[model samples]
Target: MTAQTTPKPTESELEILQILWDKGSCTVREVHEVLEKNKDSGYTTTLKLMQIMHEKGLVARDTSSKTHIYRALVNQEKTQQHLVNKMIDNVFNGSAARLVMQALGNHTASKEEIDSIKKYLDELSNQ
Candidate 1:
C-alpha cells in the first residue's frame, strides 16, 4: 500500500511492528518470545495481533509453511514520519521546534546523539 493509504498502527501493533521491522520476518512464537522479555504477553495474543495487523495491511503473512511468518508491509521510515507529524500537529501546536525542545528537555541525549542532532540541524540550515 502507498504510505498515505497505510493504516496507523495502535500502540500494541507498533510494538509488534518494531520486532518485525528489526527481524525482517518472524513467526508468532519468535515475536512472543522477544515481547515476553519486555512485557507479560501471551503467544496467542501476539498471534491475534499479528493476524489483525495482516488484515489492516500493516503486515503480510507467509502461510506456506506449518508456522506462519509475518513481515511488515508498511515502511518503517514512513510510519515514523506519519506518527511524528501527527504528534507535532496534535501535541505541539504544529510546531516541530516545540516538540524537539520538549524531547531534549525531558531526556538526556548521549554525546553522539547530540552531535548527530547538531549535524542534522546544520544540514537543515544549509538547505
Candidate 2:
C-alpha cells in the first residue's frame, strides 16, 4: 500500500498526540488517564478520538497482545513546524518576522530565552 500522509490534527487530536509524543506508546485507557489529569473527559471519548486518529493515519496501533498500544505516527517537530508555517501565513500574511515580533512583544521572555534567541541569530548570521 502507498504510504498515507495524515492531515494536521484537530485541537483535541493534537492534545492526544501531545500525550503520545511525551509518553510514547499508550493504550486507550492509558491515554485517557493522562488526559483526565488535565480535563474532565470520558475514557470512551478519548478512545473514540484515538480510533479516529488511527483511521486518519495520525496514529499506529499494535494489536500484539490484548490491549492494543497506540503510537504517534507524525514527528512532533515536523508537525509543529507545519502548524507554525500555516499560522504565519494565515495570521501574519506570510511574514515570519511579524510572527516573531508579535511573539516577542506579547509574551515575556526570560533573560536566558532572549540570550538563546540572540545566539541563534548570531549563528544564522555567520552562515
Best by lDDT: 1
State the TM-score for model 1: 0.97
Per-candidate TM-scores read 0.97, 0.90
**Native-vs-model 1 lDDT?**
0.95
Tens digits of per-residue lDDT for model 2, 1-127: 2223547799999999999999999999999999999999998899999999999889999999899999999889988988999999999999999999999999999999999999999999999
lDDT of 1 at 92: 93
Q: Per-residue lDDT tens digits of candidate 1, residues 1-127?
A: 6766779999999999999999999999999999999999888999999999999999999999999999999899989999999999999999999999999999999999999999999999999
Question: What is the alpha-carbon RMSD of candidate 2 to the true structure?
Answer: 2.1
Best by TM-score: 1
RMSD per model, one decimal: 0.9, 2.1
